[model samples]
Target chain A: MNLGILIAGLLTLAIYSFLYKDNPVYRAAESLLIGLSIGYTLVLFWQSTLFDKLFYPLLREHGIWLTIPLILGLMMFSRLTRKWSWLSRIPIALMIGAGAGAAIPAMLYARTLKQVSATVHPLIMENGGFDISAVVVVIGVLTTLAYFYFTREHKGVMGKMARVGTYFLMIFFGATFGYTVMSRLSTLIGRIDFLLGDFLHLLK
Target chain B: MNSNKTRWIIYSTLLIVVVLSYLLGINLITHPSPEVQKSYTFIENLPESSVVMVSFDHEASSLPEIQPISLILLRHLFRRNLRVVGLSLFAEGTAIGYRTLTKVAQEYGKQYGHDYVFLGFKPQHISAILGMGESIRGVFPEDYFGNKIEEIPLMRKIRNYDDILVVISIADGDRTMQWIEYAGAKYHQRIMAGLTAAMITTYDPYLASGQLSSAVGGLKGAAEYENLYGRRGMGNRGMVAQTAAHIFIIVLIVIGNILYFKNRSKGGGNR
Candidate 1:
């Protein structure tokens, strides 16, 4: 057999071995994935951020102004040291604060306003007469939302409503499960296609 | 009449239905050919050269499902000579999307910047999203390759949301909703989503109510997109395997059920 086939077979074996039971081959592949990811991220981050934003300005313009970010970046490395670890918080805090500040208002509008408004759309049709589908969708949205409406006891009439909501929730979950199954099956198919169609060229 | 027999019957019934459905292509409703209908509607509705933001919001993990849709859509956009601005919501998707976009753009002889641009992954998702609307250049000062955004031909004329016609998010998260509120509602930019099959139903209301122009959900949707573009990619390849796998699972369920019911009839223990 050719080297190419050998390598491919080994990789397939390594990946599929996880099904039978976890072993050293799986561990090796998993570790390699982590290592490769970190390495790739470092390269990308350096290319996109550090080299572009940091070194390019300094090198192209000979600007001493680049010292600020350079210093801040160096400070980030200080987290590795036992004594200077506390200094890492400045940049970490800034990143977190900025992330939270950005997420809050955007989430407020997107999750609260747009999602709620989208849920509350006209259930009955206007020009096309009545749309049962639209009414069903609206009810589905409300009931599914109600399924998660905790902080109140779901007892008696409220309990019945919650149970009704739970039914809607189950339908939603069934739909989700169906889609997820398709997606996962697709992934397996893609891999098999690579092995069968692309590589082996079998059964054509 | 026994509890065990009833459970076995339910399991076997479900198995038979699922297998029959897949093998026969039996669907309850003939889903409107999403491939043709959605793409045609999208192309005809949006004016030529309109700046459309396409987010590669999925990862390599989901490439099996998402990449085919990404390629066909890119082909459509490029074929129509649309000014495509690509970004990634998930970091893992950055390289995958960039590679796919570059390959498709090259196929159509689309020049970078003049026809399409990869903005890469915006660091802060929501802020960067809002910032894109507020000031396109300020949020992404440079292109993925580190070229200044102001100098890039694709971005030069874009001052803000006025130039942005559509924001297409293909994500696994609720970030699509973020785009709707921040860009769609805030700037009235037409939004579309190409999402995993699993996330489709939650956003169906958006598609119906005119909040989103259109969307393609999961591998089947991706396959539909591929069919429209006149190219069969991994999505179509995957369908064969998916149908086969579903059949396998259904068979397993049926066999398991048969074993259960037969054992139960013999007064065998549940264990």
Candidate 2:
């Protein structure tokens, strides 16, 4: 009954029509979504990031120290001009350098060292029994690590371990794929619910 | 039948089944998974009036999956009488987070400025995270509504991560990882995540290392939390359709694999 619901329902149907074949309706809806997304993102960026963090402080609070980053940020717009395009690299390089410098120690501790520590748990469980999952994890991690050890040839024992690693890797990939499918399906279900329940009001 | 025709048949069948499941009110009983239980218990046992910072770190595109998690967790946090400080690190999530927080807070009749406040979105995520560790007001001079931070009664008591008991990042991506790396590791703030299912595996290592206190992942995770919270909401309703769809897909996969192997055998060595 609502005009908004009718419009949304028509757009939903238009988008779904793409599964049958591409057409102008679908194309229009797609373009509309893209345009709206860009507009929304631009407004949000200006309000949340540029205006709040940069312009406000610089103007209101006498944040003279903020000018350096502001200039560097403006330099990034040099890419729009062919004559000064090289200026863009300065900001890009600074971003990459700062990102790497900040990420290295964190990644080493969080991603690498912590992960390695988790995998190297004692073979025995806290309850004084054999930890099957722990053993499997240790084997899977070592063998998987061995499979990636391309510096040496995989022969005999190494070859066997690598094959075992392949199986573990396959299992991991399968589980990941399953989870990915579930995630996508959840999104699909959400769209369907919007179409049926919200727009059509066919279900409560 | 051709593959394209077969695909349409499968798609139509799935749509019909899922729709019927929803219409007929086929609710699936969900057992709380260990991870969801861990998250629920952690929040359940928190002392009253303890401050919990919730970061809405997702976009509208993932809202269908992410919204339920955020809603249920917000409900739990509110029900516990915990002071909530909501913020967003992602630009697109700012309005969405604001809406969700406002809605849930109203359900509990929570007063703004005293019970909760939204700090709005900030860019340069790493800087925002580190800044909060030092001083939350220094990072966000004004709340999302442009009210000065010092004027908000809630913000007055909350200065840094030390003032908060926990930080929960509801995210569809690796922004949660940044929370863990910066907030959890450096500042020793307890961190939890409500993540999209696709990101669950990526954060399992952090969960194992106890870096993340707990994680509630995907729709199923939401459903479990809903059960634990004793309220049947969107999550419980969605699970019926999810289960039916999962079964249908598995059946289709098996049939497709069988057909492929059968055709391969008939072709023999020529193929």
Candidate 3:
């Protein structure tokens, strides 16, 4: 058995041992995974982002314009200081403003306008048959939106629509839950494959 | 039985079933869902030598579900002789992306700088996406291995999003939304995603709007792509175990519900 596989197998078993009871073995494995992940991420940040994007530009390319961001990034460290903690807010505000400014128009076109247009498609298809699914989607979107209309109490026709909306919401949630299970199960199957095929050589 | 004992029994049973499914090579025939088929056909119809950017936007934790998706797609792209430019938006995905790309590229006998180039991870994903619209080399001066982008033969032709045919963001989270919003909506890049099963529904609206060209989701999606690619891989094998595990869970749920109802009728205390 390869040493790497052996170590991986041990860690897998250690993590699975938690099903019986939490123990030092599981704790050790958990800590190792967390530590290794953090270490890897820090190195990647330095090599990929900070070193290439920041340091190399400042030193080698002599891109003096890069210092503005450099200063702003450094101001983020003011969060650690008692008196200068307010300085951190400058960068935070800038990030939030820039992010939102960049995001809003795209979100409007991609998420809002496009979604609304899709929902409110032509009731009749080009082939001339009534687009039943399109009508259902339009109704579903309207009723669901109405359900969140808190200004008026849900009663009479509104109550009926809200009830229908609840059913649609329930179906959506159920489908999401089912897929979530499949997602997690796929992860489990992956580990099982690694253990049997890679680690133990129990399977081809 | 004690709840802890019951839990242990359940876990052991689940593990055994999955392992046995793998060992026995249990095959479950599956048809490609429409969404997955759409994604397959999108790639299938791509012109040869078209540049495709694959953003590995996931981490190690979600690798089990997402890796097969990435691998299958990469295989298909390489098989078609497509120029793949790999990059990552997430820090954790940087190394994971490189490893997966390298492994698949080797299997296809692809040269690194000529056939595929990994641009590594970029911070501020929104800016990076926009920057790629202007100049990919400007955003990533150095490839993942610290080689100048200008030196890479593949990178020479690919200057911006316009030069690329499509961008596939294989992700576990909502990073695909950023790709769609910035890269697809703003830059008019054809964007697709290979998402974890849990995230498929979230992108349905984008798919409907044609903002996202298509998406392959979860292990099932990978399996579909593998079938399309005419090769059986981890996706096929993993699906068997997944089916077995799902059946096991369903059986357990039914039995538990039956037992609970029976006990309730007998006025037994909740346990």
Candidate 4:
């Protein structure tokens, strides 16, 4: 018997036992999973970030200049104590400022300008034919933007357009929900496959 | 019927159908999406020995879905004689990426540091991505297994995004968006994503804008990729069970709707 597979299979069964009833076995397995996750994440960060990136660089590779980030990272820990909590804000502000500075132009280009440029194509094609898909997209974009326009009361033409926008929104949400269900089923199939194939060896 | 009883019945039926599907060995037909085809063709067309960066930007929870996609893609990459540099933007995927990489590499009879090398996990994903674009070696001074990156033959030749042919992000969440915005948009590096089903629509804007080169999402996408790759794997097998479950759920939905309508006609509606 493979001890690892046996233990994992049992834990999987314990977790699935919740379907029958919420019991101590299920709770114990859930706690163990959560604990293991936190422990693993902590260890990963300690090795990857705290030790390798910070300490290694500070002591060995880069030397004194690395202390700047180390200090900023240490300041993040100040939030634990009320007396030094104000120090935490310094790093927070710097992060926000730097993050925004980096993100603004990139986000603007990727999310805004490129999107607008792509969407604002000519409704008429080069072959002198009507682009029905472009028409639908244009309508969808206009109506959806109108739906979020809260400056004026939704009345008359605006109301109809917003109503159309709601239809598009519903279609999007339905598609998303459908995909979510498919992904969940996929995950379930994966677990079952493991149990049948690897653990039980019943699968060919 | 009591609601709890109905729920249990549904669960039992699902379990039975899935088990049967597995035991009976059903295979579902899958069509390749244009997006997946684009990704395949791009990699298929890349000249031999081209360096490609594959980032595992997903946590462990979604590994079930993400792993098969990564596995098949890695198979294709290795089959085409591409040199792959693996890394994880999300910390949890570090071990998962390494395991998958090694598994696929062994199948191809590829040696480490020559054919491929895993550069491990990096925190602050945005910063890591930007840093890589500037200098990959500067960001990850050491590979995952504590080897100095400079010592690796593959690492010695690759410097930054300029040397990389494309960046493929296997993700379960929005890390692909960061890759698109920062790496693709800012640095002009080509980007593609193999992601979870739920996040497909979230990347549509990027896909439309050409910021994301292509995306293969959900199990369907994976199955399609398997078809293109011409090898049956977990993806194709999972689809059989998935079809059964979907049909079963639709039947339940139809039955529920009929009952609700019948009750309403009798003026006994409890909706």
> Which candidate number would show the highest DockQ if scored against the true structure?
3
TM-score top scorer: 4
The full ranking of all candidates by TM-score, starting with the best, is 4, 3, 2, 1
* Clash pairs (backbone) in predicted model 2: none
Across residues A1-204, which tens digit of lDDT does each residue of candidate 3 receive? 889889988999999888878899999999999999989888887887788788988999999999999999999999899999999999999999999998899989988887787777899999999999988898889789778888989999998898889988988898899999999999998888888889878876
Give the better candidate number (2 or 4) by DockQ: 4
* lDDT of each residue in B1-271, candidate 4, tens digit only: 8889989999999999998999998777898889999989998999999999999998877877888899999999999999999999887898889999999999999999999999998889999999999999998999998899999999998999999989999999989989988998888999989999889988887787788899889888888999999999989988889999999989988998999999999998686
Q: List where candidate 4 sits over 4 angstroms from the true fold.
A: B268-270
**Residue A130 in model 2: lDDT:** 99
Candidate 4 or 3, higher DockQ:
3
Residues A1-204, candidate 2: write the lDDT tens digits.
788778878988999899887899999999998998789878877987789888988999999999999999999999999999999999999999989987888778877787788788898878999989888888998899899999989999999999999998898788888888888878878877888788878876
**How far off is model 2, as Cα RMSD?**
1.8
lDDT of 4 by residue, A2-108 (tens): 99899988998999999999999999999998998888788888988889878877878758888888899899999999999999999999999999999999889
- For candidate 3, write residues B1-271 as lDDT tens digits: 9988888899899989988888898777778989889888888889999999999999888998998999999999999899899999998888889999999999999999999999889988999998889999889988887899888998887789989989999999999999998988898999989999999878877888888898999999999888888888889989888988899999998999999889988998563
Q: Least lDDT summed over 10 consecutive residues: which range in candidate 1 chain B?
A: B23-32
Best lDDT goes to which candidate? 4
Which prediction has more favorable TM-score, 3 or 4?
A: 4
Question: Model-by-model lDDT, in order?
Answer: 0.73, 0.90, 0.90, 0.91
Tens digit per residue, CA lDDT, model 1, B147-227: 988889989998777888777888765768777767776678888887877677777767755677788777777776666
Candidate 1 matches the true fold with a TM-score of 0.79
Predicted structure 1: clash tally: 0
